[model samples]
Every structure is written in structure tokens, then in C-alpha cells.
Target: MAAVEECVVVIDGANVACQKDGKVHIPKLAAAIKYFRSLELAAGRYPVNCVAFAPNFWLNVKPSPGSAGPKENGTMETDDWALLNQLVHQDHVILTPSQAHDDFYVIDYAVKYNGFIVTNDMFRDHVSNKRIFHGKRLTSNWVRSHCIDFTFVGTEFMPNPRTMERVVHFQPSATSAVTTSSLHDSNDNDVEAESDDVQEDGMVVDHKGTKRSKTIDLSEVTYYKVPRELLPMLHGEGGETMGKFQEYTGTYIVLPSHAASAAPSTSNVLTLSIYGPEPSRLQAVGHLDAFLVQMQQQYAYQHQQQYMASQVHQAGMYPHQHQPSTGTQDDQMMEIDPY
Candidate 1:
């Protein structure tokens, strides 16, 4: 039987190729993502399947065949360079560059836009980390927050970020009130969900019994149903729809994606929570841009080893051998290993 495909897998390339056991091989993680993605490659699906992000340094640094750290080489020929070139040619397994620590961009992309991530880093040390989960239960206040399932490819178990009973909110169906009940019970809350105005009979309708909008609040977690053309490859039993996330007992299949109210198109998205509400699907990713600025401040640069490097053993540390800084320019990424 052929292996089934799953959701998009975003990678922190440096995080995956950590040198913990000995000298870690750079291509091992690249091959893993490529192997899984190849199992489901097709049109629409796997078009840009496994997206990997690494610091630009990896493009030039040469790795000794058996050593852990990257060394400077006059020639650009090495296993690391070859793997990156292969990823570029394949196109499906795309490799991108991060302005700073690749981990932050990885976190932002996976949480805000894509639904699945593959890295051992859990960034709890950064103040920015609080913005995503904030110690909340891994259920959907919107869909299921803190519900990102992590896989180290060879880890023994999965993640459940908190102790609270997980809450799951399914996509409100067009015929929601009637069908799929045999599938499972809906969330038992008296306050009708703001997303879908549920009638006393659990029928979805507007106050006038006319308009049927499914747009969700910015504060809520919900899923746009996977497109009809993309569903088969994305939600197969063996796919990564649930990925490493532990399934709460009440729910089974991930309900399909569908058209929501005229909210912004998710072409290029931004994820944020503010004192006031401002949402834009096409907003330039200024948070990371701002973060990069903060990291480059004079005080931050000289004192970075004292402040940031102290976080090496903290959660969300970068998973690679440390590169000794030569203070070349404004392109240094946080490198440490704890998560």
C-alpha cells in the first residue's frame, strides 16, 4: 500500500540538524521532509509541500564529514550545499532564508498561516512566545489553541501543552444542525457560538433566517475547510492533519475547510493579538521585522551573550552547534539548544 500524505510541513533546518549525538548530518532532516512530501506530491497539493527555513550562513558554510560545526571553505562544494541545491531544484521542498534566528520566523509562519510544524523547539523563553499560547489549554478558543502537534521524527511521545480539558470547535457546517451528529457531540455551551448563530434546535441560521455567514471573530480559532481539490492529499488517515497532536476523545475526523464570511483572503496573512483589533491578511510581517530591529540595538548586540545566550537551555532554543560570532554584520541568529 502507498503511504498517505498530510498537511504542509514547515521546518527550522538548523533546528532539525542539531549536533547533539555527535556531528549531525545536514541532509538527514532535509531528506525526512522530502521523503514524506514525495509520498503525496501532485498538482495543487505538495506544490510547495515541505518548506524549510535556515540562516543564510548554511549556504556558504562547509561541514567536515564527521565534525559537528560548519567551517569556512574556498570551494562551495559540500553535503550541506548539495542538499540546499537539491531542495531548490525540487521546488516542492523549498528552502527559505530567515533574517534572524530562523526559529522565530518558523514559529510565526507555522502558527499564523500554515497549521503544521516539524521541530523540537518550543519557544517559551521569549516574551513574544507568550503571544501565541499564553499558557492556555491546547483547545480552540477559536479552534484549538496551543494545539500545535510537534514531531522530532523519532520522538517517543507527543505534546499536550496544558492540563485543562481540551475544547474543540468543528467547522460550522452548511447543514450542520442535521448531519454528522452520529459522528460526535458538539461543544456543550449555552452561549451560542459567535461564529455560527446556532438556533435553539442547533440549526444554523441568521436572526432573520436568511443570511448564512460563517466568518469567525479575530479572537476565535477556527479552520477554513481544506479546498475540495486539496482535501484528499491533506486529510488521509495517515496524513499529518492531526500530525503529532493527541486527538481529544470526543472528536475524530478534522471537518473539511469551507468558505467563511467575507473576512480577508488568507493569501498572505498576519497573526497578532493587540489591545485593539486590527486584522489584515496581506499585512507585511512587521512583527519579525520589528523583532530584528530590536535584536540589532547597540545594547542588545554587545550584551546578547549575557541576555539571549543565557537562554540556551531554555525552551525554543535553536537546535544546532553554535557558530562563534565574528561580528561580521547585522545578520547574527540566536543559536543555542534546549528545546
Candidate 2:
């Protein structure tokens, strides 16, 4: 027999969404699973030798009576979100959490056999540079390194998309009320209204727009507004105020937290260094198939050798011992003598 290349698809049961808005959506979930299975078939037909499913702990839980929700059943929620959160903090192979129960057991078996992980959650933040595919397309680098591919064909949720906007802040003094009559008279007089644009500091209003050119102590400012998208990436101008902008903003930013660990390996680095290089999908598939075939052959050969050895030993030791002699009884008795 040939050695089988192992592959495991880790399903995030929590995200499976058997129900939505208090209504059963069984057909949707089933359709999603069917689509995922199709992708698995494609993988197996090419680079993958064998495929297994990694079920999450939540799948074992039954719905509770009334509004109590899913029964605890002594199992922890080993869903994709929780698993990814835990994996980010680990270095190498670590035992799945106890709450995982059977889910952990199954995952352990797959990892032990060098099976690849198939998950949709961006759990590979710690290893972001790894390559991960969504179905047939390369979706993320994180998945590529730690596992094989991430199939997005069945996902129900897409990460929230962000939009950018401009925000303006007013100084405390600028907020003071200005009489409407005084503003009208100033415009009517057109006496080159004292330019609001101050040479160095303070509030300044220009015909183009009211431009505030003064630098006020940040401590004096009561409130400020900043674009939501820019808020995450902003750093203070001076060393003293660095990261201060984020402190004032309630929202947290998502940045590459594991760039160092996810750095490409020597082989990957070499591959990338080549300029104007085009990736060859066929070549990659061929290489993977060759490896899988070699492993299968080695395993088969070892099994055959062990079986032959056992057969030879059994044949040599058993039949002769059971043989009965026709005239040997008298001869054997005659040979018996005191030493």
C-alpha cells in the first residue's frame, strides 16, 4: 500500500451558524458544508493524499430547554475563535484546552500525524507571513505557513470594511460666541477683515477657509475628532506624545503583531528574491504529489517487510515440532541411559 499524505479540515463550529436570528437555517449550513466538501475533493484529487475533518467542541453540545441555551455537557467551547486566540499565544505544538474534550482529541491526532489545519479565522496573526488559500485562490499568507489552505467558500461572515473621513477640532477660545451683527459688519466693511490666519499661533480665519494656525498645549484641549481609519495608525509627532493619540481614542487598532515570527524562511526568502518571478501552480502541485507518493511507498514497503519476517519465523518453528515419528518411540527409549 502507498503512504497517504495526511490532511485535516478544522471546522469552526461556533461560526457554522445552524441558527440565525432565532430561526433554524439548516439548509444554508448544509449547503455551505457541501461547498466546502467540493473544495476538499479538489485538493485530494491533486496535492492532498487523504483528508479528515476536525470537529469543534461546540458540535457535541445539544440545545438546552427554554432560553438557557446550549447545555454545558462538561465540554468547553473549542470553536475557531477560541482556538485561534489560544494558538496565537503558543510557540509550538501545545495540547488543546481541556474544555476541548473530544475536539482536542481529534485535533491532537491530526497534528500528531502531520496533518494540515483548515480554518477560516485569521488565527495566523502570530505567523502572518505563511501562505493560506481560500478555496483555489491565495487569500492570506498566514495560512500558507502554519497549515495548508483555508477554504472561504463556506464562510458566513465577512470582516467589517472601513471607510475614511476627515475630522476637525476647535480650540477652547475659538468656541467663545461671536456676535452675528459683528460678523456681518466685518464682512460688509470688507476692511481686509483682520486675517484670522495668525503668523505664528492662535485662531485664524481665511477667506478660503477658517485656518487655525496656533499650537495649543494638548492638555488645554477638551475634545478632538480624528478619522476612524487613521486613528489606528497614528503616532504622536514628538517622542513624549508617541502613541498618545491611540490612548485618547476609545477604539483599538489591529496591526501586524507577529511580523517577526512570521518572517519567511530561507527557502521562501530565496524564492521571493528572484525579480519578476511568476508563480507556477502546476509545479507546486506536482511537487506535493511526488512527496505524498514517496511517503506512501515507504510506509507500504515497511509493512511488507514486517509481514514477511513474521511469516518466516512462524513457518520455521511450528510444523517440525508437531511431527510424530512412526518407529522413533523404541529408538528413543533405547537411547535413554544413565550418564
Candidate 3:
């Protein structure tokens, strides 16, 4: 008998956590993981490597005491906490940074391992809009071929039987390997999604009443200027800010490289090069400019407050000590111009 190949799997921890009772049921999630690990690749060999990724908030899910609500009300029970701790210690769980979403990490691990993703999420935000990431659009065909959804039968949790059957029988073809490159090439001629209704004119209408073209042109590029001082805030720690913007807008933002980002530039302004469809690029630039404006306004507000405090101290007078003036209200009020 030929040896069966081992399979790698990435589980969406948050999606599994809320599977039971619409709350964070750690035991249900643990059961799903245990079930996946128990699946046999050979007669006696369990060849499943299942890893779960979650946002950092779930790591601190402490149970509240003396609560009238149910145990699964977004709080971990004692046993649940213990099980979660064991999973963490075993290195089976990856808690992503709190400032970022776990979607990227989940998809990344799936791609890195050439594995399958188990989640109920349609990934509409990612696949539906034909969003491009890392030079490839997450096409529906790729998602359908690589992702798995699950269901619960009372207290038992398991992946969908049909999907599991397909997964177990899947064999990568010589020219159809599920890699970044294959996915990129496959998206050039996208097959219409089975779940969506397609019109004769090559447009797809999803259940949510949103319409999108069957094909998109990702060659469009646009640029916008920003103050150099606000670059760090725009990037955020580990580039989470810009990453979120890309995820939301479905556009890839090209900023300075690592060395250039860190070094102070002689120019007071920097340019942001956004790449995607025309509407997506416009949306990204608009949001980026809005964030910069908000930060600038906040800085101006802080500066004004500091100046007022310094002026009061220099006059040796407290704010409350100011006597009422006989002048009009406008004359008594001090106006500070914004920067």
C-alpha cells in the first residue's frame, strides 16, 4: 500500500470559539481541534497538523464571577481556561497582535503550509470583492478548493462530510499546485462563483444585493501626498494601520521601504502610491488623508492646551482665580488659533 500524505490545516480560532450558542465556547473549539488531529492519513497514522490562530483579546478571556448571565457569555469557564492554557503551552495556538485582525494570519498560514482553512466565514470581504493580496486575488475558486467549513451535531463537532471527503481525495496536479503563483495565474481568467448568481453580461450578484464584475483590472495606480511626520502613525506598529486600510479598501499601499521609513527624509512631505482598481485606490487615499488630518487636529489641540497652561503659570494665576470681567463675553474669552 502506498503511504498516505499528511495534510496541514489552519483553524480560525475566533470563528470556532463562537460556534456554539453564539458565544465563546472554548470546549467546542477544543473538540474541533481534537477531532481534526484524530483524523487518520493512513490506517494507523494520524497525519493532520492542525493549528489555530486567534486575535490577542481571546487570550485574556477571564471568567467574571457572580454573574447572572450564561457561562458562554464571552467569558471562559475554569475548565475552558485550563484547556486554552494547555493548547497555548503546546504551541498549537497563535495569538496575533491585538492591534491587527487575525484574518491575514489565518490565510497566511494556509498559504505557507499549502494547507486548508477551516472556518464558517465566507471571507466575503476578501474573496467576494476579488481583493488582491500579495499580487494575487483571493478568487472564489481558490477559496472553494482550499477552505473547509464545519458544523455541530449536538455536542459533537466535525468538518462538513462532503468537504472532508473532497479534501481527503485531493491531489495536486502537475500544473495546478495551490501556491501563490498558481493562484495569481488562475485569477486572470476567474470562473464564476457557484454560490453567486451570474448575469448574462458577466456580472455577479451575491445574496447581499452587492454587484461586482467577474473580472477586475488591478493595474490602476494613484498617488497622494502626506506630511512626513505622520508616517509612523499611518504605518502603526508592525504596519497594522496600513494593513487594515488595505484589507478594508482592497488596495495595496506602497510606502517607503523599511530603511527609508525609519530614516528621516529631507523633504517635509512623502507620497503614498496606492495600487488597485480606480475606485479602490480613491477610497484608500481618501481614508489615509482623513487619518492624517485627524492626527494633525489632535496635535494642534494638545499644543493649544499646553500653551494655555504655560500662560496661566507665567501669570501666577489659577484658572479659577480669574475675576469676572465687565467686558462682553467675547472680550473675556481668549481665542487660540489652530495651527
The most accurate candidate by lDDT is 3
Tell me the lDDT of candidate 2. Answer: 0.29
Better of 1 and 2 by lDDT: 1
Task: List CA RMSD, all candidates.
Answer: 19.6, 28.6, 10.3
Model 3 residue runs over 4 Å out of place are 1-4, 19-22, 42-46, 61-63, 66-79, 129-135, 170-182, 186-327, 331-339
Candidates in order, TM-scores: namely 0.35, 0.23, 0.57
lDDT of 1 by residue, 10-44 (tens): 66666666557433345665665654455343343
Model with the higher TM-score, candidate 2 or 3: 3
**Model 1, runs deviating above 4 Å:** 1-6, 21-24, 39-48, 62-77, 92-98, 126-129, 132-339
Candidates by lDDT, descending order = 3, 1, 2
lDDT of each: 0.37, 0.29, 0.64
Report the error of model 1 at residue 10, Å.
1.1
For residue 104, model 1's alpha carbon misses the true position, in angstroms, by 2.4
Model 3: per-residue Cα lDDT over 1-339, one tens digit each = 122345777899988887445446677778878888887654534377788987665656455332354563345555666777788888888887543447767886676556788998766655655555455666555666677898877658878888787556544341137554335642454334434324412555463422333333334668777766667667778987776677678776666534334433356676666667788888877787688889898877788778877877956766566665688745533466758
Worst 10 residues of 2 by lDDT: 268-277
Q: Tell me how far the alpha carbon of residue 296 in candidate 2 is from the true structure, in angstroms, after superposition.
A: 57
